[model samples]
Target: MTEIPKAADADSVTEPASASTLLARYLHRQRETILDGQIAAGAHDDPDAVADMVVAARRARGALAAHRKTARTQPEVHRLIEELRWFGITVGSAHELRTQAAWLLAAADLLRPRYVRGPVRARISGYFADRTRPAWIAGRELLASPRFPAMVEDLMAEERLLRSTVVPGIDDVDNTAVLEALLERVRSRMRAVESARGEDTRDAAMHGLRKAIRRTRYYLESVDDVAPARNAQACQGLAAVQDLLGGHQDAAVAKHHLMQIAREAENAGESTFTYGLLLQREIDRAAQYSAALPSAYWQALRGARVMADVHLGSAAE
Candidate 1:
C-alpha cells in the first residue's frame, strides 16, 4: 500500500483548513488506490484478481478526474491526465472481454439445466474457454508493457508535487460554486444523451449515456463533504440511472459476442442453435432495458434539479 503523505497542519495553513484537508485526503486516497491496483494486476494470481484490479483502476481514474478539474493548470498534471487516459483505454479492452465472458457464462449456466443438452453445454463451454484466452493474454501484455511502470512512476512524482504545491484561493471558492459547476456538467451530459438518442447509432448513444451517468455519479461522490446528505441522495439517484443504462449496454455487447460465437460455430460445423437462442435472449433483455430508460433518465434529471436548488441555495446563504 502507498503511504499517504502527511497533510500540512491546519494551524499552518494559509487557506481554508477544511477545504485543504479534504483535497489532501482525496488525492492521497487516489494515489493509494492507483498503486494498489497496479500491484494487484501484476500479481496474476486468480481470475477474481482481474475484477478487483478493474474496480481499483476505475476508482483511481475517477479520483484523477476529480482532482484534475482544479489542478489542470500544471503542465505535469495535464500530461499525467492524458497518459492515464490512454492507460485506462489500454486496460479497459481486457476488462470488457472479461465482462463479456462472465455474461456469456452466466447465460449458459441459466440455460444448462432446462433448455441446453450435454452437447450444447459442451459447445458453450468451449466457446467461453476460447474467448477468455485472449483476455488473459491481453492482461499479461498490459502488465509487461513499459507504459504501466512509467505511469506508476509518474503518479508518485505527481504526489510529491501535490504535497509541495500551495493551492491558491481555496478560501475564496465556496462549496456552492463547486456544486453549481458539477450540476451544470450533469445537465450538459443529460443533453448529450438526448442528442445521442437522435443519432443513427443507438448502441453508441446508450453507451455514451452510461458514461455520462457514471461521471456525474463520481463527481457527486467526490463532493460529499460539501453537503453530505444531498450529495449522497444525488449519488444514489445517479447510480440507479447508471445501473439501468449499464444493463442495456451489457446486453448489447453480449448480443454482439453471441453473434460472433454463432458465426464461429457455423464455420466449425457445430450446432449454432444454442448461440442463436442466447442471442435472442440478449435482444429481449436489451429491449426491456431500453423501454425503461426514458423514465429513469427524467427521474434522474428531476432529482438533480432538486439537489441543486436545495444544496446550492443553502451554500449561497
Candidate 2:
C-alpha cells in the first residue's frame, strides 16, 4: 500500500528534485553496475534477477521518454509517468519500474480497451498481477521515496487497518478470499444504490465510483494491479457518462434539499421541481454506462495483467 504525500510536504522539501534526477543519477547507478560497469557492491545471490530489473527499468525509462516526447497523447501519458515517479525517483529495479510502468500500460489499455490489446496491455498486465513485485525493490536502499511523508503514511496505514486494501476489488488471485469478499461488498453496494437511485442514491453511487477510480489510479504504478485493456474504452465511456450524471446528481442534491426547506416554510415547491429535472437527467445519463453490458475490470486484467510485486536481495520471475 503506497501512500499519498501531501502537497504541503512537497512544498516543505528543501530541494525539489527535477523530473530528470532519477534517470540522470539513480538509474544510472544500477545500469552502470549491470551493463558493463564495476562489480556490484554486494555478493548478489541473484544477480540475474537484479540485472533483469535493471534492464526492465532501462526499457521503461526509454519507453517513457519516447512516449512523452512523441506520443500524441503526451499529456495524459506523461502525467501517468509523472505520477509513477512522483518522488522524482525512478527505481532502477524491475519491480519498481514495472510497478510504475504497469500503471500507464494498464490505463492505456482501459482507455482504449475497445480498439486493441497487446504488450501495450496484457503482458504488462501479467506483470501487474504477479504477486511477488512489491517486496523486490523494498530492499533497495536506493528506493527511498519522498512520495509519501509521515502524515500521509499514517493516514494510509489507518485506512488499511479499517479496510483490507485500498481497492478491495483488486485482481489478486492469491487473495481469492478477499476478492470474493469484495465481490459481495460490491454487490451489496450496487443493490443499495440501485434501490436508492432516485435522489440520494445517485450522489452516493457517483461518490463510490469516484473513490474506485482514485483507488485504481493509486496502484497504477505501486503494484502490478493493472486494469485490463479489453474493457478500457467501455470503462472510460462509463466513467464519461457517469461524470455528466454526477454533475446533475450533485445539483439535484443541493436543490432538493434547498427546495425541501423552502416547502417546509410554506414556500412553493417550484425550485424542488428544478432539482427533480436535474436528477431525472442523471437517471438518463446512467443508462449509457450500463448500455453495453461491459464486464468488470478483473475480466480485463485476467486477459491482460494481474496484481502483485516485491523482493530485492534475491529476485524472481
Candidate 3:
C-alpha cells in the first residue's frame, strides 16, 4: 500500500497573511516533500518513496492549475506546471508496473490449485519483471537528469513569484471560489463519464474523473489552513471517489496485460484458459466498482457543498 503523508501541523506555522502566501507555502511544502522522496528513492528501491514523490508532484501541479488564471501572463509558470506533470508520470510508471503485477498475482493466488495451470505465476512474474526493470531504469535516469533539478528550481521560482505578487482572486482571504471552480470541473467530468456511450470512452471518462478528484483533494489540502476541519472532511469524501476509480483503472490495466499475456501464451502453444479466467475476473471487479461509483460521487459532491456552506457561514459572521 502507498503511504500517505501526515498532514502538517497547522499550529507550527502562522496563518497565511494572504491567499498568495498560502499558495506559496503549499508549493514550498510540496517541493520539500518531493525532494525528501527523491533522496529516499535514490538511496534504495522504495516503492513508497516513488509514490510520495509522484503525489507531491501532483499536489504542486494541481495547486498551479487551481489558480491557473492568476498566472495567465506568465509562461514560466505554465512551464513549471507541465514539468511537474511530466516528472510525476515518468517516475510513477515504475511504481505502477510493480503494483499492477502484484495486484494481478495476488488475485491469481486466490484460485484453487486445480484451476491454476501452465506456470501461470512464473509467467506473470517474469513478464512484469522484464518490463519493470526497464521502467525503474527510466525512472532512475529521470531523477538523475538535469531536467529533474531544473524542475525543482522552477518550483522554487514559482513559489517566490506567488509570495511576491498579489494574484487577485487567488490572493483573497477566502479561497472558496477557487475550490468551487475545481468542484465544478469535477461535476463536468462526472457528466462526461455518465454520457460516455462506448467502453473505451467510459474508461477514458472515468480516468478523467479520477484525475479531477485527485486535483480537488490536493487543492483542499493546500488550503486546509483556511478551514482545516471542513477541508479535511471534504478531502476524505473525495478520497472515496478517487480510490474506487483507481480500482477501476487497475482492473482495466490488468485486463489489458492479461490479454497481452494470453496472446503470448497462445503463440507459444500454451492454453490461454487461465488468462481468460483472470481477464473475466478483472472485468467483474471493474463492473463492481462502476456500479458503486454513483454513491461515491454523491458523497464527494455533498462534501463539497458542505464545505462551501461552512466557508460562506464563516464569511457572514
Candidate 4:
C-alpha cells in the first residue's frame, strides 16, 4: 500500500488566504518555469530538454484549468487559457512522438542481448532513430513560428492583468468551497471511469481515467495548504493509480507502433521476428497493467470516499 501523509491534528487550524492571491502566485511561478523551459529548449537540440519543456507547459496548463472557474468572466484570462490549450496540443504532439521513439530505442537496447540478435537490433534502433528526427523537426518548426513568441508575450501581459484584477468568486478566503469543488470533480471523473470501464474500446477510457487521476492529484497539491492532510494522502493514492495506468497506456502505444514497424519490415523483406517479439512483450505488459487496475481503482475510490467525508464534515461544521 502507498503511504499517505498523516493528517495534522484537527485542533491546529490555519486560515488559508484568498484563492485569487494563491492563483496569482501560482501563475507567476508557472509562467517563469514555462519561459525557462522554452529558453532551454531553444538553446539545445536535446530531446530531454524538449521533454522538460513539454512537462512544464503541461503543469502550467493544468494549473490554469484548475482555477479557470474563478476567472471565466475575464476575457483576458479566458484568452490565455485558450492559448495554453493550443500550446499544449502543439508541444504534446512532438513530445508523444519523441517519447515513443525513445521508448522503442530503449526497449531494443534492453532486449538486444536476450531476445534480438545481429542486424535486427540495429534495424530496430535505426527505425526508431529515424522516427525521432521528424518529431524534432516538427518541434523546432513550432518553436520558431512567430506565434510562439507572441504567445509568450501575451502570457506575460495576461499575468500582469491577473495581478491587477480581483477574481470575484475567489475573494472568499475560506477554501472549503474550493475543496468541495475539487472533490466533485474527482467524483465526476470516477463516474466517467466507471461508465467507460464497461465499454469494449477501453484504451481511450483508460487514458481518460489516467488524465482524471493526474488532474485530481494536481488539484490536491495546489490546495494542499487549504485542504486537510487527508487530501495529500488521497494525492498519493491517485499518483500510484496514475503511474499504473500511464505505464499501461505507454505499452499500448508501443505495441501499435511495433505493429506498423512489423508491416514495414515485412514489406522490405527484412526480418520481422524482433518486432513481433517486442510487440508481444508490450501486449503482455499491458495485460499485467490491466490485471492490476482493479486494485488501484479500489484504492483510489477509497481515498475519494474519505475526501468526500472530510468535505461533508467540514460543511456540517
Q: Please tell me which predicted candidate would have the highest TM-score against the true structure.
A: 3
Candidate 4 per-residue lDDT over residues 1-91, each given as its tens digit:
1111222222213423345545555555556666666666767765456565565555555655665455476666667667776776665
Better of 2 and 3 by lDDT: 3
Against the correct fold, how does model 3 do in TM-score? 0.90
lDDT of 1 by residue, 1-317 (tens): 22223333323345433544454455555556655555666665334455544544455455445443454665666676666666665555666666777777778778856566336555656776776667666655765677666766676665444445654433245645555565566567556656654323666777777766676666556556656876787788888888998898888888887787777777878777777778889888977887888888877777666666765575667
Residue-by-residue lDDT tens digits, candidate 2, 184-275: 44345445555654645655665564333322322222222223342353345434434544444444433443344334333432233332
Clashes of each: 0, 23, 0, 0
The TM-score that candidate 4 achieves is: 0.77
Question: Residue 30 deviation, candidate 2, in Å?
Answer: 26
Ranking by lDDT: 3, 4, 1, 2
What lDDT would each prediction earn against the true structure? Answer: 0.63, 0.35, 0.82, 0.66
The candidate scoring highest on lDDT is: 3
How many steric overlaps does candidate 4 have?
0
Model 3 spans with C-alpha error above 4 angstroms: 1-15, 46-48, 172-174, 313-317
- My TM-score estimates for the predictions, one after another, are 0.76, 0.29, 0.90, 0.77
